[model samples]
Target: GAGVSQTPSNKVTEKGKYVELRCDPISGHTALYWYRQSLGQGPEFLIYFQGTGAADDSGLPNDRFFAVRPEGSVSTLKIQRTERGDSAVYLCASSLSGLLADTQYFGPGTRLTVL
Candidate 1:
């Protein structure tokens, strides 16, 4: 009934721990996106999935970060060996379609604090 939503609004973990952030997009949306936003910086696109496949993943810094949308509705972002620099707000967004003019709606985000 609403737009996209993310879970674990705040997460605190040790540097070497693994973390999983979840996102639930609006029903019927064919495009989903994951983004990372540092304090005072704009959200940077990490991975975008059109349907069930990643359309773009160039923004992922390394293999430590990965995302998946198995059934094309709920997606998860996984981080391995988290670091201090890896701390940021993970945002999820969705669009009706991946078309150029399809407006993307973003969720509140999950704040990750790596200690």
Candidate 2:
């Protein structure tokens, strides 16, 4: 009955570098999502997966960002060419379905700091 969890809670990276942030979803949940939250802003959906396929990825900003959920349970967000603007809380959430109204339980997030 573990809830969604993210590692490293904080990360500091140099510009133009690459980073990977991980997420572990709740048991038995087949839906997982990744979102980025900037200061004082709402979480912007990045990608969502149902089972092993990415059901929605339109929210990803550009090619520099990517995510995967190979096992349908744990997910990882990868960023290439890190920029100062990419510094934010990378949150992970999970729900029972990919439906619009499903309540997503979020993790504390890995705060990526770009220097």
Candidate number of the best TM-score:
1
Clashing pairs in 1: none
Worst 10 residues of 2 by lDDT: 96-105
Clashes of each: 0, 0
Task: List where candidate 2 sits over 4 angstroms from the true fold.
Answer: none
TM-scores for the candidates = 0.98, 0.96
Could you list the CA RMSD of all candidates, in the order they appear? 0.7, 0.9
* Per-residue lDDT of candidate 2, residues 1-115 (tens digit): 6788999799999999999999999887789999999999999999999999999999999999999988788999999999999999999999987688998999889999999
1-115, model 1: which lDDT tens digit per residue? 8989999999999999999999999999999999999999999989999999999999999999999999999999999999999999999999999889789999999999999
lDDT for 50 (candidate 2): 94
